[model samples]
Target: MRSAHRAPRRLTRRHLLGLGGIAAAGVAGLAVQQLRSGQAPAEANTSPGRAAASGAPSPSAAAGPQVVAKGGGTVPYRPGRTILGSYLALEGKAFTESIALRRRQTGRDQRIVHVFYDWTDTLPARIAGLPAGATPLVSWRGSAYSDITSGGSDARIARAARQLKRQGRPLLLRWGWEMNGDWYPWGAARNDKDPGAYVECWRRIHDIFAEEKAKNVSWVWSPNWNSAPVAGWNSFEALYPGDRYVDWVGVSGYNLHRETPDALFGPIYRAFSARKPLMITEVGSMDRGGRTKADWITLFAQWVEAHPAVGGVVWFDTDTHPGYAEKWRIDTDADSLAAYVAMAKSVRFSG
Candidate 1:
């Protein structure tokens, strides 16, 4: 694992996007309403001018729900079963030891292990340290969109793809995730706000992986639950690389404040649940504002049960920084750990 350096609090994506503010201002109430009504909030303007300014395709050109390609590379959809997983930060601890501790604490075997790599980093050999039968969900960050689409990153991408193929086991590859947000270099907001560039970049990499015959890899396309800029152009619809290129649709959502699972994932479930196998690619919560994490986890389990299209969830179970306001680790407290254990051990999440 790479050195554990935390992003400064001031520059954190959630803080910059005012998600906390939304929760503070009663967005959770609206989210509950949305969940009950099976409706999403009104979308932003999709006018041609806005699309052009953001370098996104017009709504007419954006792809909607359609029949997607299926094959050995895709994850098998199980209607009522979800794979429970987690991303463990090194945080000065040995990776294998950390996994062992997590297993002992949760009392359930994680089916997926989440790992991250930068655009220039090689696939770490340490993946072999993961528990037997656990699949790896690799979140590979990308460089600038133009750099990628222009073939400048081909060698690097092909190298990773070849490495994955050598693994000889099914793996989930999430490339350039959270592109709707402004935090990463590959995000549309940083790449001339051009969602088209993002799509091109993704397709180019997917093609390179195909050229490498990485058939064991399942492509995962993930975005933040809400756009950072909160604009139509940055919406998931505008940034989608289309169903044919995506094996799974995922979202990163966190209850940084008082937001509930319905508030965090309702809109995403409503939009793409029918189009692709949906997963909560990244999720966590902070106990705050008189809300208990235990109750929140119970509600989240119920929500997933009510929505059958969701087949996987990866918890962001790490406290990245000291004194962080959001203690995301599942075992932050005994109650939180108990709640997570119950969720992980439940038949619905049992793989």
Candidate 2:
């Protein structure tokens, strides 16, 4: 009845010692606050104006179902031209790749990339290494997802929200994304495989963010495909917190388990259709499957085009799996690339 992974825990001494590489990574994390800034380190020749701009709000804004207040004013969430960007590994590559992708999407003309801000690395102790107003990290580990104060503390969440506001960027935050399944500590079914606590935790996280006046943030609530025996109708929605906290409805799905694109993604599309914008936060066809990248792209495009409510889809570019290697590439699969290009160009971005 359970099928998700748990959040990675602090490494043990043996693993820390044996896995010297990861140990160094941990230390590296602690070594410099700059590294946690979520952007490339500052250069010696940098100008002060640019540095100041880092603290300003980001220009890339979108529309969604939720509304946030800025300077005591309210705004709605709208979908933008979002490219599925990776964790830190793809941060730098985003600039070049995003530009190329944008160029390719000229026919469609959407101007944005829906990015994944890997909390551990990007949300550092200080902004020394980050660009300014970058992605903020709100995690679901501990009881943060189910018990607001259990994992995510109000103070910490407040600080992150304040920092993002100061930087002047709109945040598309997906906290404890795939909660229905059991892999993560915040998974809905963890204790008794029930979702009550999970919903409580989600509500709590929302309270903290809202009270803190983190106006530039847009919350995206996403869960993996419902593979549990009950077809994923877990009680997670009980914790929705409300339309106040959520701006978009999203799904972290893949072309795994013989799921038809529509079947796998339909529930979410229907669930949040009237209340919020919808997105495919993470998805890719695996290589091990008989499906080829071109075929997957065609299928995905055909499916997306059929859904008028679906605002956008962001492809998870990781090639870590078999059939997925060529999936995220912008050029390898001509058909897929062309489809993305077309969509990007056609969509109207929300600022």
Using TM-score, give the best candidate's number.
Answer: 1
Per-model TM against the reference:
0.82, 0.61
lDDT of 1 by residue, 113-148 (tens): 888776777875347577888888988877888898
Worst 10 residues of 2 by lDDT: 47-56
Backbone clash pairs in model 1 (N, Cα, C under 3 Å; residues 3+ apart or in different chains), count: 0
lDDT of 2 at 93: 48
Candidate 2 lDDT by residue in tens digits, 95-160: 445444444554332222333333332342322223232333223233434235466466666665
| lDDT of candidate model 2 versus the reference | 0.45
Q: Which stretches of candidate 2 lie over 4 Å from their true place?
A: 1-147, 150-152, 227-236, 287-291, 320-327, 346-351
lDDT of 1 at 157: 85
